[model samples]
Every structure is written in structure tokens, then in C-alpha cells.
Target: MPLQTVLVTGANRGLGLEFVRQYREAGWHVIATSRPLDEGVRARDCGAELLQLDVRDEGAIHALAHALEGRKIDLLINNAGYHPGAHQLGELDYSSWQTAFHINVIAPLQIAEAFLPVIPPGGKIVNIGSRQGSMACNREGGRYLYRATKAALHSITRSLAIDLTKRGIIVVALHPGWVKTDMGTDSADIEVEESVSGMREVIADLGQHNTGHLINYDGAVIPW
Candidate 1:
């Protein structure tokens, strides 16, 4: 059997890096992208092909698609994201909010569009979303920038799932649990390994029956 290939964005560290590590260990072909070329050394050490990619750069995204034009991507994990720090109502940073929208919401959709030709039928595109994006799950009221962008990303995921149905491509947004990464902080709920493993399991089980939903790492469906 031919090895399956997975392309991961923001793979320099954290959950993205863990995905590259685990997939490579599972004997899959992993193409890992990071903003800085040098930061992908760890992924390269894990036997992944490293690519420098700033998800916000449209030209770079297209160039990457062109470079890997004929290669079949069994899975594409849109893991690049940005989280503007906690801000009070009056202290909100509009600039960071726009940046977050570009990285967290728009970049994923653009990347998916650029790579559409490489992803064959039955392929999967997993957008890394957050539980904070859930309108029904919002108890606290901070992180406006991050929360808003993730919500928009979830919307995009649903729309992509519907639009790509004819082509037999599966698209879903996954919340990787509160993990012990730089973004998640040390006091988070789970380790990066556990979150990535759970998400991988969910991705493996995705099909037409469950293509357009926001799912948690543990396989529970999150309310939109």
C-alpha cells in the first residue's frame, strides 16, 4: 500500500509539530510548514519535508501549491492560527484583531482553495478551531479577537464541507482541547500528544456522514 501524505501548517512547535512527529512515526509522508524556514528543523528531524510558509502570505501559499501540484495530499491540517491576548472592553486591539482574522479565519480557507487540486476524492481538510468559538459554550467574555476569528473559521469549514461535497472531499473544524502548548499555557487541560492523538482518531473516522461539524478532540460534536 502506498503511504498516506499529510500537510500541516504552523508545524514549528506545539500541536502542529506533534502532528508531524506522530504522523511520521506512523509511517506517513509528512509535509510540515512553518513561518521561518529554520524553525522546521525538528519536523525535518522527524522525517517530514519542511517548507517555509507564512499562512498570511497568499503568494507563498500559491507557490507551495504549484510546487506540490502533482503530489496527492491525503490530509491537510490547517493548523496555523493567532490568538490576541486577553483584553478588556475598552482596551481591545483592533490591529491584532485584524491580524487574527487573517491568520485564524482567512488563511485556512485560502490554503484549502490553493491545495484543492492536490487533495483527491475522500481526502480530508481539518481546520484547527477552538471551543471558545462555540456560541453556546461561551461562559466567560474575554478573548474577543480569538473567539470571533475561530467562529468565522467554523463557518468556513461548514461552507467548504458543503461546497466540496460533489468532489468527495471532507472538511471539518476540530478543537484540540486546552493543551499544554505555548498558546494553551502550562495550566491547560491536556498534553499536546493526547490532543493530537485524539484529533487524529477523529480525522481517521471522518466521512460524508460527518463532514461539516465542529468536533472536539475527544470526538464529541461541539455546538455551532
Candidate 2:
């Protein structure tokens, strides 16, 4: 049997990089994409097929879709994201808000739709979401832009899970926890290895049964 093919965006760093690395190490064929594929030596060393792709770039998505046309992609990890300055509710920067939505919410959905047909039955979509995105746990006020984008992403995940079930594809939002990445910052509680390892294990074990659910890296369900 051929190895499963997994494509992960934002592969230059953080969780995306770990997914590519670990999947490749497991003998899967990994197609790692990033805005600057040339700069990611770590991803390249993982023996992945590197592609230049910015999630916000529609043309790039189409180009990539065409490049992989007719091939069966078993898994897609939409890990690309951007969190602009933590804009308070009233003082929000409208431009940054739009940019965040473009990258966090819209781009992933567009990428998935653009490549929908090529995904094989039993394939999966792992959307990188956040706990802050969860309406069930939105306590503090502030960071409206990032929170909104992720919440929209979670909504998209639920809708797509139902819409794509006929194709036997699984779509679920995954919160990688407060990871110690550039996005998560130094004071984050979880290390990158711990977060990614837990997520990879849970992700590798998820299926159609878990579609549309919001789950933590450790496989706990989260309220929508």
C-alpha cells in the first residue's frame, strides 16, 4: 500500500513544522507548504515536497491545486494563522481585523473547498483553532479580532463536517493549547513538543465519528 499523503500549510514553523516532521518520520509522504518554502530547512530535512503557498493567496491555492490535480490527499492540516496586535473591542483596528479574518477564517475554508474533490474518502481536515475561539469559554474581554476569526473558523468546521459527510471526509477544529510558539509567546504553559505530540496522536486517531466537534490537543471535547 502507498503511504498516506498529508499536506500541511504554514510548515515553516511551529505546529505545522512538527506535523510535517512527525508525519514524514512515520513514512507518510508530506507536502509541506509555506509562504517562503526556501527558508524552511527543517521542513526540507523532513523529506517533504516543499511548495510555496500563502493561505491568503487564492492564486497560490489554485496553482497548488492544479499541481496536485488527480492525486489523493489523505489529510490536510490547515495550520496557517496570523494574530495581529491584540485589538481591544472599541479600539480595534479594522484593517487588522480584516487581515486576521482573511488568514484565519476565510483562507482555510477556501483552501479546503478548492481542493475538496481531490481528497480521498476517509480523508480528514484538521483545522487549527483556539480555546479563545470557544464561545463556551469566552471569559475575558479584548482580542476581538483574533477571537472572532477563530470562532468563525469553528463555525465553518461544524458546517463543513455536515456538508462533507457524504464524501466520507472528516472535518474538526483542534485547539493546540497554549503552545510555546511565536504566536503563543514565551509565557505559554505548554511546550511545542508536548502540544504537537498530543495533537498528532489525537489527530491520527480521529475519524468521521468525531467530525464537526471542537477538541483539544489531548482529545477532550470542547463546547462550541
Candidate 3:
């Protein structure tokens, strides 16, 4: 049988890079996307087919989809995110907030839309959402831009799950936790390996019934 193919966005470093490494190690065909040309090469070094993509660019997404038309995509992971500006209630840059929304929210949905035609039945889509996104789970709230955009991602995740159900596609929002990445920072609770491993397990077990759920890396269901 042919290896299952997974397409991951922003796969140059951090969680995205780890996803590529894990999947490749597990004998899957990985298609990794990054913005920089050197980063693309790094993805290639990690045993993935590299595609240069800036999630913010809709035309590039469409072009990639067109280029990969007829190819089977077993999984799509939208793992890119941008956290901008101060989280303080009123001390935010409006422009940075717009950028955060564009990168964190709109881009993932656009990428999903572009690739929908080629994803085979039983294909899965995992949006790398944040626990901060959960309105029900937000206790300390303040990271306005990041939080709002991730919340929007969860909303989109639910919609995609419902809309794609008839076609046998599973869509779910995944929170990787406060991982030790640049975004997560050095003070985070868990390492990249632990988080990615847990998420990989979650991905492996996903089915139609799991669609639309907000799942933590450790397989716990988070309130939406």
C-alpha cells in the first residue's frame, strides 16, 4: 500500500517541524510548507516534499492546490499561527491585531478551502487551535488578538466538520498546549516531543465521530 500523505503548513520549525519529523519517521509521505526558501530546504532535509507557501497569500494557496490536483491528501494540518501585540486590554496595536487575524484565522480556512477538492474520503484536517480560543475555557483572558483568532478557528473547525461530514472528511480543532516552542517560549510546561506525540496519537485515532471536537494533545476533550 502507498504511504499516507500529510500536508503541513508552516513546517519549518517548532511544532510544525516536529509534525513532519514524526510523520516521516512513521513512514508517511509528508508535504511540508514554509514561507522561506531556506526553510523549504530544511523541510526537504527532514524527508518531506517542500512547498513554499505563505498562508496569508490566497493566490499561492490556490496555485498549490492546482499543482497538486488529483493527488491524494490523507491529512492536512494547519499549524501556522501569528501572535502579535500586547495582550493588555487596551494596549494593543490595531495593525498587529489585523495581522494576527489574517495569519491565525483567515489563512487556515483559505488553505482548507483551496485543498478541499483533492482530499480523499476519510481524510483528516487538524487546525492547530489554542486552549485560549475556548470561550468556555478562557479564565485569565487578555491575549486579545491571539485568543480571538483562535476562537474563530474553533468556530471554523466546527463548520468545516459539519460541511465535510457527508463527504467523509473529519475536521477537528487541536490544542497542543503550552509547548516549549518559540511561540510557547522556554517557560512552557511541556516539550515539543511530548505535545506532538500526543497529538499524533489523537490524529491516528480520529474518525467521523471525532470530528468537530476540540481536543487537547493528551486526548482530553476541551470545551468549545
Per-candidate clash tally: 0, 0, 0
What's the distance in Å from true for residue 20, model 1?
0.3
TM-scores for all candidates? 0.98, 0.96, 0.98
After superposition, candidate 3 runs with Cα above 4 Å error: none
Worst 10 residues of 1 by lDDT: 86-95
Residues 1-224 of candidate 2: C-alpha lDDT, one tens digit per residue: 67899999999998889888888888999999988867777898889999999888999899899999989899999999998885775676787777899999999999999889889889999899999899889888688888889999999999999999999999999999998899999999998888988988888898888999999999999998
Q: How well does candidate 2 match the true structure in TM-score terms?
A: 0.96
Please give the CA lDDT of all the candidate structures: 0.95, 0.90, 0.93
The pairs that clash in candidate 1 are none
The number of residue pairs in model 2 that clash at the backbone is 0
lDDT head-to-head 2 vs 3, winner:
3
Q: Please report the candidate that would top TM-score against the real structure.
A: 1
Please give, for residues 66-146, the per-residue lDDT of candidate 1 as tens digits. 999889999999998888885668888887877899999989999999999999999999999999998989999887888
Give the candidate order by descending TM-score: 1, 3, 2
Model 2 stretches with alpha carbons more than 4 Å out: 89-91
Worst 10 residues of 3 by lDDT: 37-46
